[model samples]
Target: MTELRDVDFFRDPNSVVSPYSYMDDLVQNSPVWIEPNYGVAMVAGYDEALTVMRETETYSAAPMIAGPTPDYGVEFTGDDIDEQLDAVRHRLPFNDQIVAMDPPQHTMRRALIMGLITPKRLKENEDFIWQLTDRQLDVVLPRGGCELVDDYAQPYALLVVADLLGVPEEDHPMLLEKAGVAANGSLTDTTKEPPKKHGGLEHFYEYFTDRVESRRREPKDDVLGRMAHATFPDGTLPEPLEAARIASNLFAAGQETTVRLLATALQIVGDDQGLQQKLRQDRGLIPKFIEEVLRWQGPIKGNMRVARKTTTLGGVHLKAGTQVFVMHGAAGRDPRQFDDPQGFDIERPNVRRHIAFGHGIHTCPGAPLARSEVRVTLERLLDRTSAIRISEAHHGPPDARRYDYLPSYMFRGLTKLHLEFDMEA
Candidate 1:
């Protein structure tokens, strides 16, 4: 049997997605394989992925990326990946962002955020979510055909996050533009330079810093306002810079992930009228559909962690400091995990088991918010549109479309998505 190498997977995520045919072989042959160049283990099987996630003691989130810091700059090397990840675990800027920490710290931070996402808050946001969805649809629905990425998905995702964070409606337009630019600014290619990379981390820091200052002076009911006054169990709160980082993370990750999810779902349902009608007729199935869409086309491609000690994964020996990427997208489609994994069946029973939001301690803190956003937005679209179809301007089968996914190996999302739909009948 041919041994699967992790280097190939990291260097070429696009090839791993398709009829390229090598993926299945790689998965079956060596679900936990090593990347020759990066010295990272590629974990693709569902069970193994879960193992990596849950075993926090042996594995660390330290090697999550190769960046020093978002604003100042942090060079992420194999060594720094492990060290830096460990260092940032407890430094929650405002309250407990939770995602950056481990163990007891992670638990405490998570509890605080979870309290905010209670059923009451979700219910309260129901009408608001639909209103935002409608605003997005109103613009795109009139166009009849437009790139779904910018026209619909981008706004939909940002608005959803904004609603939860209590961002002002007036700031929506500027925030959306900045978020998009930041998403596209990940490239390092000098030849064929991108349209614009001028205003990214700089602009983001300025925006969040200003927002943080405003919240400090005049507290409101939104997340920003809450963070401004939040205190840990010890009665201490994050410093100014830390608070800004938390907000920056929420803005960047929230907008990008949801945009990808929305685009993926539209592409899937738009390709099949029967599926669209099924969802439209029985809105009850919308939640289940959302779960499946997450399973089939999860936004995050993978996340990096480091082995804290020597270990053997997938029969391959991994020495200490070896970086491992928990391949969520690959594992979601793993044949071992779900039957007919390649097909997008909304009614799939195992949909809930999907690791799109991740597993164990580091599961996304904003999951409740994401679930609510997709469910409400999709249901409202079905309520408003008579028929939904892909814009001919963009061509491809549901899964084969070329997603201008960010260059980063960590987060996966499209740069643009073109879609079309009919007016209400």
Candidate 2:
């Protein structure tokens, strides 16, 4: 077994920037070892992670983010897990968010969310993706070099999601400002400090409440309008706060993950000229390339699930309420599942099997939209750029490059990607 004291996977600054080296070690030595540092079970094996995800009855998706365990102030020596969960949830700020709920509650809320992003809706939004991509590119095309994350990926993602959610043009700045801060301190951040109530939720709450009220008064033909008047499976409209929570969850969750995906994809292509040229030459490979990127450098590092009952995972006995970190990043490169798992091969078969967007019922609902955004963005980028390369001054040479990833155990993305590209004449 690997020593937990040797590597602080959660709080270590280096883990935020580059965790694959550490993950590779963990997967090899201790696929199911409990890290004494955080006192949480780390599930690193590909099959083990999937088992935890698929068996939702045994694993609860509550407390999707890692933080200090909430104190309900009562010691329960009872067999009723449901009662214990209810008591603990009462203290969590995001208890009502769809991702934090288990069946029955999650079922209805997820239904309402699915109602908003139907195929037709996503297809319609797909058309807007090109326009949005080009508009952002126009801003950076004149400049030969730009920081990809701030100048392009971040704003582009925020705009696309804002447009999809029917956020007004005037409110764009506020949404960006508030959501940017909240995205960093998301449930995935591994700091030991107690999780504070996110301000972005408050921002979205007010914004969506007004929008929902407006839609109720005068309906329109947009996603917000659909969500504003959406009903549960039982034909009852969600409560005002519930409606706001749905919108807020969509807004925050959708943008955060997509931004990371875009930045990571761009960084990969930017750093490898030969691969960039190959992708540029054969546009058909864009989808496959995107899939490989998700497998190799997916934005989500892991997701947390609590054990709902006593269960054995990877031969380790887990009691109810134990937190499990399904290491998606590690699982993608598990040699048992994929041959040459470390290589970034776009043509690799089974690349789509990666759980970057997660798996089972809690799989990200905005995945389709995220995929579309990445595809359109890559297509337009190759169309407009003659050559795209990483800025060596910002990140060092190929032998020793310096890239800083987001400081969160749950997310894997560079904080900034500086690139120099020549626009096609």
Residues 1-425 of candidate 2 have per-residue lDDT tens digits of: 24443787878887887789878877776778677776678888889999988887888777677442435455434333666876677565467688878888988988888887777877777888899888888888788978877777777777677777777777777776655532222222325544447524777787888889889999998777887889999999987778988877776687778988988898889888899999989999999999999999898999787777877899998877777888999999899888898898999988999998888888998888889999998999899989988899999998889988788988888788888889898
lDDT of 1 by residue, 1-425 (tens): 34344335555655434311443555666688765665668787888889899988778764354322222133344422445545553342222334445666666555545554567766766668878777766766776767777666666666666666556778876665655532222222334545423214444566767777788888787766776666555666756555555555555556667777877777778888898999888989888988998887788768777676677776788776666888887788888878988787877887899999898878886677688777877787787778887755567665655545666565665666666767787
**What are the Cα lDDT values of the candidates?**
0.66, 0.80
Kindly provide the TM-score of model 2 when superposed on the true structure, using C-alpha atoms: 0.92
Segments of candidate 1 deviating more than 4 angstroms? 1-7, 13-23, 67-112, 180-223, 396-408
Per-model TM-score, in order, reads 0.81, 0.92
Best by lDDT: 2
Strongest candidate by TM-score: 2
True-structure lDDT of candidate 1: 0.66
| RMSD of every prediction | 5.5, 3.9
